[model samples]
Target: MDRPWGVPSPIRPGFAQAETAVPLMNIANILTMLRIALVPLFVVALFVGDGHETGWRICAAALFGLAAITDRFDGQLARKYGLVTDFGKLADPIADKALIGSAVIGLSVLGDLAWWITLVICGREIGVTLLRLAVVRRGVIPAGRGGKLKTLVQSLAIAVLLLPLSGGFAAAGMVSMYVAVALTVLTGLDYVGQAARVWFAGGPGRARGA
Candidate 1:
């Protein structure tokens, strides 16, 4: 029989209780959804007025920044409130990739950023995502500090590049982008290593035995 929320299923004495179910809709999930919804609007703002009008560029950056802020809070809210759900797990990363990918790609298309940079970052993101899925059955790979830092750097770089800035400010944006790309590659390698460890440990089941 299916166990109801807060109802403990059969377990050996001294074992921890089964976790209660979290609702699919919650503040954290709503924030993630909002981030995803902003992507299209951000793209539109990016392309408006030949994609270079200072006003429209600011609008695009604001939209992107808002989306990134949501990314920051949603995870915290989920963990703090014990509101993590399967849907949130799936959608949160998708929303992040969509937002970042769109920003970089749109900037490249608009000639604001280089294509190689976009390709490198996007490739790494896609590769890491695939690695995560490949090892998901073994265990969930929580985001490490390095990964969080990389995301922060990437979002900041994208926001700077999205703005209609030039001179030293533009140079700084490029420099930050280089740093973001470096972190992307480094963290991707780290994730691959973590996945390998999880797979070798025979997943959670065998790890518990060990």
Candidate 2:
């Protein structure tokens, strides 16, 4: 049975069987793959013409925005349509990290953003991703509200920073980025705590209700 979004489910044999009933190539998974595919294209746009050409920057921001939109829809589609499969569980976050990672790294490379900010945000994302993998056998820790808020803020900040803006607009972007970074660190710590609980609980059977 489909549970609420972000709630962990026990990794039982029956859970695997239920997941098998959902095809791998559902709409949600397709959107997720599309988001992943857009990353390289977004990078290309970002780097075109010395990586700061006005038109190219606009194109890159547009591509990033599109990918972010897909990220929003896919999860909702999966839950509403009962299309949540194991592949979706794994690939969705990977797609998110790919898009966000590429954007921030590309921005840093172009000197549009600070390397320290990039390092902190990317570091937290990478660490959380590894934590998830380290405890995959326990259960999937779905993105909580804090995590979702962080992504939303990160995307907004990146979108602003991608534009060739200055003055107050530029300051606004930095402020937003700072908030996103704060959320990133806070949520990362929360996920780590959750993973530790799930880990010491022995398995998903016990972690599910947690």
Top-lDDT candidate index = 2
Regions of candidate 1 where Cα sits further than 4 Å from its true position: 1-19, 202-210
lDDT of 2 by residue, 86-122 (tens): 7788788889889999999999999888999999988
lDDT of 1 by residue, 1-210 (tens): 553332333556566444355667677888889999999999999999889999999999999999999998888777766666667776787789889999999999988889999999889778877876677677767777888889999999999988888899989999999999999889888978888998888453111000
Residue 8 miss distance in model 2 (angstroms)? 22
The total of clashing pairs for model 2 equals: 0
For each candidate, how many residue pairs have backbone atoms clashing (under 3 Å)?
A: 0, 0
lDDT of 1: 0.81
Model 2, global lDDT: 0.84
- Candidate 1: which pairs clash? none
User: What is the Cα root-mean-square deviation between model 2 and the actual structure?
Assistant: 5.9
